[model samples]
Target: MDTMKRLGGDAFAPQTTYLNSASTGLIPAAGVAAMHEGVQATAAGRPLDHFRDVEAARAAFARLAGVPARQVATGASVAVYAGLIAASLPDGAEVLLSEDDFSSLVNPFHSRPGLKVRTVALEDLADSVRPGTDLVAFSQVQSADGRIAAVDAVREAARAHGARTLVDASQSAGWLPLPQADFLVAVGFKWLMGPRGITYLVVPEDLGGLTPLLAGWVAGEQPWDSCYGPVAELAHSARRFDISPSLYSYAGAVAGFELLDHLGIAAVRAHDAALADRFRAGLAELGHTPVHAPGSAIVSVPGLGARQPQLSAAGIEVSDRAGNLRASFHLYNSSDDVDRLLHSLT
Candidate 1:
């Protein structure tokens, strides 16, 4: 069987057309099974090591994110991780951001008082980093239109300016090879093909000077021993920053990560991007120009958002964002899916 089919064919119905991975990924059958087993174990009150699943998922995410397991902190959402980073910053610190970046990545900084938040065009992100910039935060692959950031340029600028970096990979992980950042957060639902309520945060070796604002018993050096009292000693690593894991969510995430490991990100990226490129070409022939995002797996066409309902009624799945019709191709999507959408648009 083809690799994509081997990984995800049984996850969808025979004629299901899902092109909205940028919105939410279809959880593979393996993930659903794992989650079911977790629930069963819970119902039976059987001794199951839920934390073991969390560790397994965390380690898998660490490998995919190219960071040490000790550097990864399991969380529930990007907003919480962003809040952690926001709390770590000194008052009046200058933060640079992309104006059109996802709200979860943008809103946290605004919520923090006395921080100088500057927003610029996504294309101007690297150039906007100045000497006074304490941190530069943006999404790796933009959710609104799938425009990939110039990560290297931004990293270089941040380094030259002695600034830290925060990258939200919710729209890019599992397919794109992510660059290292001082802080990175990715939700498991989108692109990672896991259930919701699972998020991963990669912090620096020194824990990025972040306070464990939401630390619970899990953040203890010895979690079981520290229950019912303040943690005797916080975890020495980024584990200190961990929020309690959603057990069943981690179970599903571990399965999702296993599939991703077997498929490999490079292969997935090629598969997804090819379908996206095919759709882009067909859009040109149909006289519908999409957002220009070279080498991205998302195709967003402006002024056609009204057609989303028509497409959905015809059993197509896509997103309409800010008056643009967005279609995100994942590993499971094929050229046939691309052509089908193009035909519907015609």
Candidate 2:
């Protein structure tokens, strides 16, 4: 099967090969068209009619994330972090997290008074859980080193310690399997091939003891009621975190989700894993060491002193993040791109 045709024409243009899907995916033409249509719909003064597509986007996101539509909210990953942290913790409660966790997930708890924050190294995760830890927050895949944590083990540990689990799937979603957790947050931009400003917060249906700190108009049960009235009951799922809707982002997400559905996530995952393996093999032949061996779709090859510019001059578009030459592969990337990158490195 030709993967290039599956990625659409926009992804095939020979200007610059995008091996940075871990950073920000290249928006396909279908996504662009969806965004344009969303704008046009709003400009026509029929915003009410746009709700269908908005709901469809929500449902598509939920389906892709393997959760119910109500359990999926659309927002930035930071917003999801804020909502999840606020809804899952109480005053004076401590939330245990890794020292290398994303700053967005840590900042909210750090800003609150009486909220204790503990940071542990990933190597000490099995022994890190304590009795007083209210929530254990970590990422399924570490963005920096591409190290995949044993999420099931962490979840079980957290459960044994009477703590909830919050997972950051920003670097893992759409490319890896959804690990079991109490709550999971994923951004659409990175691996989902969607536009930015959209993310999903998955909350289990049976767990509901905390209240959201930043509830807004769309969060209440009767969101259309008078602005000055009593706060209605919050929704049972992640929609309680929806402060407001971004119709344009929703449309773009719908297109992205459709593309993924067409290609089939299982196939995409297999193709990406193969590509990462190929890239890693090539990088090894060139005497470069990979950060964590290609675990997911992301492969990080550490370059020797100041070799990035030379590699770029040879027509490889790689990112230098934290002193590592990160070469990310997606379904759109072919074996030829890997060969070209290897040729450049040598």
Candidate 3:
């Protein structure tokens, strides 16, 4: 199926050429139906229907990550999993993070009583790892500049020092190849095109005896049976870290996962890259030189921050942050979107 033709691509309709998948994705028609079904089920007192969708969504994300279903857990948001990760680390351990990375990872460790937070340049992480560092955390892709981090190298360096790693994959998951890390968290709202409030937390099975940070009924060896027991043993899998998403959100994520599964993650990635390349080339031809970081699907138009309103006035949608007019690409975007953006600039 032509990706654009699939999922009722014309759903965007008479106006609004969406080019902001980095900020939020346009949910597909099937996804909307799934969400509606979930909502109706909940309304009819069948809220438990969410677990099946949640399980299916977890499996889909597992396939995307090239991991097993046992390593995937549903969460409410990135911050929730970040906090759990922070709490699981050994007390007084030092954590290294990039200076410009998102704060969700940092704020969690900052609140931990004895943990030490260290800042280093994103490019220097691989060189900065040391024996005493217990954890290293950073984004798989930088949200601001859309730079794909040297995360695998960072992971290797951390492992060489016997330290674990956490990768916030919020910007790269669903549409990009996932990095190998000790932990990863991705929100479903962006590239996955699911409803907001659904997040997937990935932790390998070999991570043993992690002290549960946000232990709940579902985080037990047996949720329904272990209720109110004396801090029951955490489940042997990553599901132990789950902060289960609501029924509606779970249904939406499942729908999004199904769409990605149907289209193939690699195909979506190639499409996004092609569109991003076109955007950069077109802007450059129009005298708008783009700042690019290798392997990222974001086109950075410098000095676009001030002209964002004008671009929007001309019916273009993108994020303007600081000095950058950041336009992200996905399967839904087309050549016309880039052309319109260039024409608006001219």
Best by lDDT: 1
Instruction: Kindly report which residue pairs in candidate 3 clash with one another.
Output: none
Residues 144-239 of candidate 1 have per-residue lDDT tens digits of 898999988999999999999999999999889988899999999989988999889999888888889898889998888878878889999899
What TM-score, over all chains together, does every model reach?
0.97, 0.89, 0.91
Alpha-carbon runs more than 4 Å astray in model 2: 2-14, 44-48, 83-88, 226-230, 303-315
The models' CA-based lDDT, in order, is 0.88, 0.72, 0.79
lDDT of 1 at 130: 94
The residue ranges of model 3 lying beyond 4 angstroms of the native Cα positions read: 1-15, 44-48, 226-233
Residue 29 miss distance in model 3 (angstroms):
0.7
| Model 2 agreement with the true structure over 1-346: per-residue lDDT tens digits | 7642234435435457667777887676777887887677678975545456667877886776677787776666665555556556678787888776677776777776778888888767757888987887888887765778778888888889998888888887777877877877788887777888777777777534546665676777666762555557776666677757666777676667777778777778777777788888877777777877446777776654256677666666777776777777776688777777777777
Q: Please tell me which model should have the higher TM-score, number 2 or number 3.
A: 3
How much lDDT does candidate 3 score? 0.79
Candidate 1 colliding pairs: none
Candidate ranking under lDDT, highest first, comes to 1, 3, 2
**TM-score between candidate 2 and the true structure:** 0.89
State the local distance difference test value for candidate 2: 0.72
